[model samples]
Target: MLDSLRKAAGTWVAKLLLLLLVGSFAVWGISGQLVTGMGGNSVIVAGGTEVSATDYRLAYDRQLSVMSQQFGTRITRDQATALGIDNQVLAQLVAGAVLDEQARKLGLGVSRDRVAALTVEDPAFQGPDGRFDRNQFDYVLRQVGMRPEDYLTNREQVAVRQQIVEAVSDGLTAPDAFFRALALYEGEDRTVDFVVLPSSLVEPIEDPSADVLAKWFEDRKANYGAPEYRKISYVKLEPEDIADESAITDDQVAKDYEASKARYTTAETRRIEQLVFASEEAAQAAADSLKAGSTFDQVVAAEGKSMGDVQMGALTKDKVPDPAVAEAAFKLQANEVSPIIKGSFGPMLVRVTEITPETVKSLDDVKTEIRKALALAEANRILLDVHDSYEDARAGGDSLQDAATKLNLKVTTIDAIDRTAQRPDGTIVDDIPESAALLAAAFESEANVENDPINIGSNGFVFFEVEGITPARERMLDEVREKVVADWKVAEVAARLGAKATELEKRLKDGATLDTIAAELKLEKQTKRGLKRQADDADFGRTGVAAAFGVPEKGVGLTPAPTDGGQILFQVSEVFEPAGADASTLPEQTRTSLSQGLADDLLDQLVARLQAEYDVEVDQGAIQRALSF
Candidate 1:
């Protein structure tokens, strides 16, 4: 169940909606008041509302587990703390509590019926019939370690927060003037004429003397310093390593195939579209119209219904909301339409757009797959015992090697490697499994400290003990002489380029044209025409684009380029403002987008006001203590 709980925590409902269920952290405003004299189990106190430590821990653990699964490694508590998961989870909880508190003050009471309706409406708790199923709801709740009451409470909070958001942003709209101004800025284009200053055009440099090179290396020793590397020995236990040892008989494979026969069989299915009507007479009239050579589209349009208003796309028999609708729908051939059939909703006219024949595989067809699956299952079961045995041995103070030997597992050791899994020669160490996890644990643990075991995906566990530590040291000038000289040349060239670009910029600011500057400096003039404010040009990247829009017409600016010690000295030749007529031509999508942005700003301001009125107080110590578990 813990494994099930972990896997469920990463689902879309838990990771996305649960985080948003409490509203964003930006919704909260807290004063400097520190609420004291609370029990250790209390995390936040919003007016009379208190969020419990148990709920906070659950949220924190879910987020931590999700991050670990995403990065393909075990994330430690220290890593979670460093990543600020504690603060993020606590902030969401506090904000949710604050909203609930404010809602209560305004006499906003959510009925249990409302929460129950939302629960029944959620797709997460729906079965194949596309309707609410109590069994499914309970199963999903159990998977995420939540009771029905707790889940409903979360849904109620979400409903309340949504009410607050709606109230704050109600009837919000961006003014025409505001959109016109934004359009002028966003849609404006610019033409720029520029000249490049390459390092190759700079004055040539001679090789530095020994004293100069040594001084340069001394000044930047930290850059040339060696990163700390650890020497570690580890024991890895994988189900794959023990899979071949687990023998599977043909009888067992056949039994497995029989038990999972559904996986080997496919039922015939139809792609259906249904139009449901409220009454029998309306449905019969529509069906009669279709029979009288009127197209379905015409019939729907005559009834004042758009295609989207009535179309239910692509459902199989079991997926149809009404059993009678499913039966009538499946009875039709491809491209065939059915007469109005009595449905749960009312009357439904179903159409079959496509049909798929049934498919079934014989035992011989998937014998190899079944055999492998059986072997893997057996191996996984054995690995669980192996993990427990290894832990017992470690608890008894046995060495990693001794524990491995006792469990008949091999122990692999790397003589010298860094956290990047690289040797001194920069070659990757391939033999180590779960190298990232092992390295993180090794570096965090002191030398000779017993390392905790980390889960590797589903069927493996790795444990390591750090044997030695080599403190990081700075290399002498002679040690990396070539790299030092190369770095020195780069810096010197950049400094010269910077100075040259500055001189040109000063001359342009002194009222010289780009053409004159290019001719004086013996550089080629480049022109970019009709460049939008946010457009990314191959000639001018984001930096140049920003400069083009930022500088006034006929003003000069400099942008650094990724090319070797390169710079672009440009003058904005023309600025094009959006015309008044262009605002009328703006697309509805653009208008909606701008309106949403303005509404978001309004909502933020409203939240700030609400926070001031609510007087939210968070117990930092209590939150830290709750998350420490």
Candidate 2:
């Protein structure tokens, strides 16, 4: 009932009500301290409707809970304020109040019987048997900290608000001219004749003199500066680090293998084909035909059935639907047909096309697997003890290295890594556990601070500290001379290519055929047809395609190629307009989208008008007090 109301109300009222409904269900039991702190204050007042401070707090806490789940951590009040969640909650509450005030002024009311029917039909209150259960209804209300009377009142308000929303925006549709213009814009096609000018066509650029190169380096020195790097040292505690497969005795391996024998066994299966008939006489006649040297394919074809219609791929006996069919199918050898069997559906003839025998692995085949599983299980059992011991040592004032050393654990040190976990030389620092989280924590810590361990799920922890820092600095020209020269060459080539493309575009505009130009330059001339506005092609990239469509038929344009710093010189050859179909006959999905857009516009206008009439007000002090805790 609420979901339907939300859809009918469009976005403004829909979003406001949705947040209220979600908060009511997801957040529970506001503290008495907060209620007392808020004392007699209303967070928002619009006309005759008022939102109490308690309501605002409930909504804000629910949004915070949702954000914490998304980030896998708790969110502080400061974080919520930074995210603008506090303001957003206040705004939603104000919108709801404005709508409620308008509904009250207009005297819109829903019948008690209608509200009762919607509650009983709500799936949230349904039981296992799919009918409204009194116990489930009571339990859900208690869980959300709402009384039955309060829930019904809320439901009644939603229905009343929906009446106002639907009256203004229901059955709205976009004008036919709007859809026709959109269709023409989207469906128009183009054809272009083009030539590719590769960078190789440009003459080799001469190297700059020493003075010019030095000046170039001075102008762009910042581009060659090195990024700040940090050296991080960490210790990881994982189950695999302590697991000892060799310590698992042969007797334990044998016992585990015997207990889990089914894991190593494969059940027998057979490929079966079945043909069901209405009566025993029809089935027996078909079976007799197979016995008289007629092939199964011939009998199946005579019944106007294809092989796929009857083929049931390899399945175990238990997987077969009918017990009678299962028993008979296993009894027959490969390529043998059975007489009419009374299947669950009807009398049927079955044939076994192939058989696979059951096979059990020998103890030696899986001994190592069993041993490793047992060893991992044993390691998991004692991982907590190791974690506790390390914590105890830390509480006793031991450094990360000392604690790890006492436990015989290895501490890994990365010599230098940037924020992206890359060395100054641009190679990735490999094999860091939880690199993203670890690097984020490492960059935020000082060299001597003892950071808390990051829990890598339920299995392990990574304790890290920053060991050293390298401040970023400008690189000397000599250190990056080779790269500078290479980059200069690429820029030089691109500039040359742009000039050549501009010259070619002018020649084409002056009535030179692409074929003649291509023949003169010994380059291939290609033509692309049926290119839509959204076409993605290898040679004619998005920019090139857009250039093509921007011009009228026979107009010339140029753009750089999607790859290789090449250029495309093209002239539009043809244009295809959308077919002259009735614009009213738009696709159902397109029509619904346009209608919803129109509805949203109407709802926005209505809400704005109501806000102006109701004179909505917000109490920032009350909001701050509610969120202070």
Candidate 3:
């Protein structure tokens, strides 16, 4: 919570997520397993775990959450599909289970005491008073769909796996050689010899005759056809707009002020030193010696653990390894011995030598806070009433005018916008126009004239209607002739470039020199800087770098590479082979990365993994059902 107020000023996506958290949207659709449904289902399996609807739905929600973070509140379904969340989520669950099996085989273990200690000690799972709050823990558990017992079991597994991860990943460091290679790949710069073979290089003859043009249009009829859209008017019922607000009496204000006085208090915090022993026996033995009226320093020294050494002193209850132990100890007198309590550090007795209690403020001290809280409550009551009025207005099939009149809300009219104008914020909707359906419906059909209400977005259910049509009439041929000619020329140039590449390749095979071809094409020899196999950020970006790599290894001559600027002729003046992979440079947790890379780059690897784990049988009945509705 170390966030600044200014940070949220432009965080629209964060605001959207907050709305989703409070609104509890109920979009209807049951997912998972082969059930009797119109929607067909597919299963991704690994080990013995089944990927069901429950898992898929969770994965979808998680994916949407991430997309919203990256692209703001407005995300398209296509974007989610491209990210491969559906497949990745299943793969992750499978890999997690596989790792669990491997961990079990290795006999890696975490103790029950450690789990208990960690849970109670986490500030998130604690109450305002800094004590372990079971209600908070249970609330989070219910939110994520796990019971107390089930959560504890999973937590245990997580702890054990974490230990295995720590042991394996500890000091496997990055080598200098690896860093050098990475820098080379990531930092390489390239200058290239190229020429723009724009289509303009070729002369345009004439536009296709009417007969040819008509045939081309008919062949691609699908592109010209428009999608179906709905004309809808909705009466929205928002809770914040309809509540009743009544004035509060002076007596009530005083009462609230008195009751909330403690809100102004700040709890005292403790500074402590913690030492986790290697074994419970050693911890218990140390505690026993300290309890025998021994000087805390003396006990440490006797046990070969000193103040200057490890395993030692000075703790406030809140800083104790276990919250339960802390609470019990903080309640003790100074220098008091706590019962042998099991904590994250194992069995121990704490001696709290300090005491500090929260200081509460007087009623007058918190009067301002009371007033602010009352104002918000009163405002909400007023909003609730407004919401009810809106709901009533929407009851009948009412026009926007009728709904606005009934709700006492001012109806604002907007006109002359495209499918892109749904959002109030002027942001580009990359790859998709979410407002396409509504905008098209408003303008395309003749039936939807000027009576549409403002349409709300995903969270807002406001309706928008078509006020007028601004049809995109085709431009006169003479007006766009220059552009058409330019496009035709560019295409022609690209073809010429392709022909030139073919001729160059043939001549290079026949032992042509770099200078010979250069002089023949009236091109100069161009030199480029650094290049890499994996990260091709050379001359331009990927396309240019790819062309560089595409150069023939043994045979010499210029290779034609594709580029946005123009076609580039890359000559393979030198060749560099990668050194063998360094063991020290490899990531200790390479299994998951390697597996994912294999799936992405090698079709055979992915299919092999899929076959090895799952006996996949597609049921046509289920498949058809899933696709329907």
Query: Can you write out model 3's per-residue Cα lDDT over 1-629, one digit (the tens) per residue?
Result: 00221233144333322222211111111222323332435333333434444434544454455455555575665665576544444444443343355466567777899879866875556777989899987875555444677556556655664554444443444455655565444344333434333323233435656565445455544444332323333234333233222445567768886676556766653433333456778777767776676766565566565455432345534455578666766566655656566676566555555556667777666665566667667655565455445556555666666766776554544433445553223344342223565555556546444333333443233444444454444444444445445554455566666776667667756777656776766666655544565454544466556665565544333333444534454555556534443443445465344433333333223333443444333233443332232
Best by lDDT: 2
Which residues of candidate 1, in runs, are more than 4 Å off?
Answer: 1-12, 15-20, 23-32, 39-43, 52-80, 207-214, 222-487, 578-610, 619-629
Candidate 1 residue lDDT tens string, 104-144: 88888779999899888887878899999999888877766
lDDT of 2 by residue, 24-143 (tens): 111111111112233457877777888887778876765565555446799898888897767666655655666789989888788999999988987777889999999988876664
What TM-score would candidate 2 get against the native? 0.64
Per-residue lDDT value at 59 in model 1: 74
Comparing 2 and 3 by lDDT, which wins?
A: 2
Q: Candidate 2 — what's its lDDT?
A: 0.80
TM-score, every prediction: 0.54, 0.64, 0.39
Candidate 2 residues lying further than 4 Å off, grouped into runs, are: 1-186, 267-359, 581-629
Give the Cα lDDT of each candidate.
Answer: 0.77, 0.80, 0.49
Candidate 3 RMSD to the correct structure:
21.9
